[model samples]
Structures are given as C-alpha cells and as structure tokens.
Target: MQVIINGEVHDLEGQILLSELLERLDLKPGRIAIERNLEIVPKANWASTTISDGDRIEIVHFVGGG
Candidate 1:
C-alpha cells in the first residue's frame, strides 16, 4: 500500500494500524501527534485507527531545543 506521510509518499505492506505504524517506525507514543486525511486523530484512538492505501498521515513529534 502507498500512503502520504508528512508530504512524502511511502509504500507499505498489508493492513496496518496507526499504533503499529508508529511502533514500526520506532516513534514514542507520547511524543507525537497525528493527523489522518486532514482530521486529527486523538492519541487514544491511534491504536484503533487503521491506515489504508492513499491515506494521508501527518506525524508531528515534539522536540526540545533552543
């Protein structure tokens, strides 16, 4: 499957949930925000949200810096 994430296109395999995608990418659950298909997906719903082909995902991670 192909999806757009943060303005880039990514090709992924099989049906995958948001949480699983994050885990596969090694992203910390508490450190990021996600928007799917122009809608904000709550952190709690990430586990239940399924990512499909052509879906647009925006992942914003918090960073501490000056």
Candidate 2:
C-alpha cells in the first residue's frame, strides 16, 4: 500500500494503527500530533486509528528549546 507521510510517499505492508506507525518512526507519542487524510487524530484514538492504503498521514512533532 502507498501512503503519503509528511509529504513523502511510503509503501507499507498491511494495515497499521497510528500508534504503531509512530513507534516504527521512532517518534515519541506524547510529543507528536498526527493528521490522517487532512483530519487531526485525537490522542485517545491513536491506538485504535487504523491506517489504510492510499491514506495521507502527516506527523508533526513538538520540540522543546529555549
């Protein structure tokens, strides 16, 4: 399946939840915001949000710095 993640196209196998994808990308769940198909996914729903083929995903991370 092909999906666009953060402006890049990626080919993934099978379906995966948003949380799983975060882990695969080595990102911290608590510090990131996920948008799937132009809709923002709530944190509480991340675990149950399943990603399908041709879905567009955008992951944004919050960085702390002064």
| Top TM-score hit | 1
Give the per-residue Cα lDDT of candidate 1 at 36. 97
- Please provide, for model 2 over 1-66, each residue's C-alpha lDDT reduced to its tens digit, 9 standing for 90 to 100: 888999999888898988898888888877678899999999999999999998999998767778
TM-score of each model, in listed order: 0.88, 0.87
Model 2 misplaced stretches (Cα beyond 4 Å): 63-66
For model 1, the superposed segments whose C-alpha errors exceed 4 Å read 63-66
| Model 2 CA lDDT for position 36 | 95
Query: Model 1 scores what on Cα lDDT?
Result: 0.92
> Candidate 1 clashing pairs?
none
Clashing pairs in 2: none
Among these predictions, the greatest lDDT belongs to 1
